[model samples]
Target: MSEAPHRDVLITGIGLVSSLGEGLDQHWAALKADGGPRPVVDRERFAPYPVHPLVQLDFDRQIPKRGDQRQMEAWQRIGTYAAGMALDNAGIKDRTDILSRTDMIVAAGGGERDIAVDSALLTDILAASDPGRLINERLSSDLRPTLFLAQLPNLLAGNISIVHKVTGSSRTFMGEESAGIDAVRTAHARVASGQSEICLVGGSYNAERLDMLLLFELGNYLWREDWLPVWQRLSRGGGLVTGSMGAFLVLESPAHAAQRGATPVARLDGVRAGRCRRGPGEATAIARRQFDELVSGLTGGERLAVFSGATGAQPATSEEQVFLTSLRHADNHIPIRAVGSIIGHGLEAQFPALVALAALAVSHGMLFAPLDDSGCEADGSAPIDRVLVTQWGHWRGEGMALVAPAG
Candidate 1:
């Protein structure tokens, strides 16, 4: 049997929603201006856990008003909004043509509980001892659909399909912290093999939830006030780049898009996934090797900027720092942009969205400033090329950059 011909996938449209703002215009402008996470006026929103900066998004504009809004969860809403915006930007009004040729792949971290809670409220009206608050505060047009099933992990992708009436193949995969890379890898293989012409791939997290914050703290993965000791030991504080939410891109073959008269925005180069070197003091060393292999397939050092998976934890951040240090040593001196700081650690869903944001920056010549923290500084030994302005007591470690040779 002969193997299918490989094709070059191109990104033609981009849509993004984050605390920084909604739509690519807002996000791209903010990125160039170096915007940080939005202010959380409702600090009690995630009470009982140490406070962390979160990426805030405007939900009102993203959710549809009529039928579409009636059928999805917040996470689904995020994905749908982004996908629609991206399609629109790509000059695709009716997705039928693209839908017939593409598949949907999603990377999700959380929000199933929100669906359950909403369902419980709808079905058990009598169980609502506090109907006053529920009626006044929690009502949504989206919650009215009894037939809608948004609790499933795949609901984000499913909702997109339903809205677009995309009867093609759709699948959602779960990959703990690696889901972002995993989703891209899945899409890359399918597109490369001619199984799909386009892939709407991204992830989203309801990180503002109190429950998630508590869970992260329980795992000792959160950065709270007590991390002051850890911060003190650091030679360089990182930048904050919060703006969590979902991002979607219209990814299709360059040939197919050209055949359809669509302009390309960026190339969906390639993605690699595997455990980086990290254990005890060797965290940085492992990360360096891992990232090196990640870009190894690209020939001739194509000026590459990395969107690192920095979780703001001791091991994760330190390993990332080592990776950046290695890049500097190789004379790459690539800039590092951290998104998790602003968006909080989104776990599974964070990477896909961050990838979209970084890709936008790479193709557009913008570098979002990290949230500023006077006390926080980059690791002196690491040789970071740029600093994202970060807020005080906040740490930023995830990085996204463009591919460019030493300037």
Candidate 2:
């Protein structure tokens, strides 16, 4: 019998961090156990608002270094932590060594979370001003700098590039929640086109405060009151009320990894994405194409373990369910894991985490169950594993990834 030909673009490393914990192990454990971390709302930042269930992370404690800390923001810190983990996992001690021959694609979501110029700071400034105070006394550069570097979303990728000395095509993408998947697609294309040998792709977002939530409240994008727990009724899901963190993946050409004797972590068969018309069933149309392109990308008669982008949102998750139910031949018996329930929707930073999780499942032969929020259907008659993950209604996109059997 002839040997099966090698697939292209193998994922070599993954780094993920959320409120449940940091690193792949924490994410893996959280998923296996199905944990749902709540939001962090402090009286100081979010005056009068109580803390609810969220996936908040503290980068200060996780990354302790003044030199590395000079201009880094929370999300960037998270991204750096995950990047270090990924590089270490891949057994590449020096990023400069890899950059000499490879490319870097840092997927990012959300602007830098700098409390200095945030609403909280502005409020403090206004409160401090007294009518009797002199005009000059009311304003100072110390109070607010004209230009703050943390406001830019690309700061994470820039920091990673600076630390790694990555020269080949170092750039960042902002696709709101789809940035992570977009990063993988970009890296995959780069490797396929022989532009570079290895590509670092991932994204991060950390919402440690409730300013975003306030915005969500105003925009009416958050889940309605009925979706919130009794205690969280006052809080809205519109903004960054979840966690603060980062996740990343390393992609290398299959031939390159094999030739260098690098252990293949997982195979990335193919990736495809598209948009549909806006309307009632538009999500289904969009998702159907997304699924078809992804599944059809497979070459041989390969079995599939699907990772659905079920965000727990009523409209989105419903569409995802409809699309998954339509998969042909694959018995609904196949296990489907909704990832966002554990991590919340990393928003734009989401796809990177999803890609990393999918790679982890493929490499380890394990899938984290989807969060089991109220609206989910749990009957076993459907032939789907429908493993109710410990997490709950936190998915956001209508996409999925398949894992091929190990070599």
Measured by TM-score, how close is model 2 to the native structure? 0.75
lDDT string for model 1 (197-252, tens) is 77777676655555555555666655433222222323434222222366676677
**Which residue ranges in model 2 land beyond 4 Å of their true spot?**
1-7, 34-64, 113-151, 223-241, 297-303, 328-330, 368-370, 373-400
Q: What is the lDDT of residue 374 in candidate 2?
A: 39
lDDT, candidate 1, equals 0.54
Using TM-score as the measure, the top candidate is 2
- lDDT of all predictions: 0.54, 0.55
Where does model 1 exceed 4 Å of error?
1-5, 34-44, 47-71, 114-151, 226-244, 276-290, 294-302, 369-407
Q: Given candidate 2, what's the lDDT at residue 111?
A: 54
In candidate 2, what are the lDDT values of residues 24-95, reduced to their tens digit?
776667655635323233334444332223344544443556577667766677787777667767766474
Clash number for every model? 32, 21
Cα lDDT for residue 360, candidate 1: 64
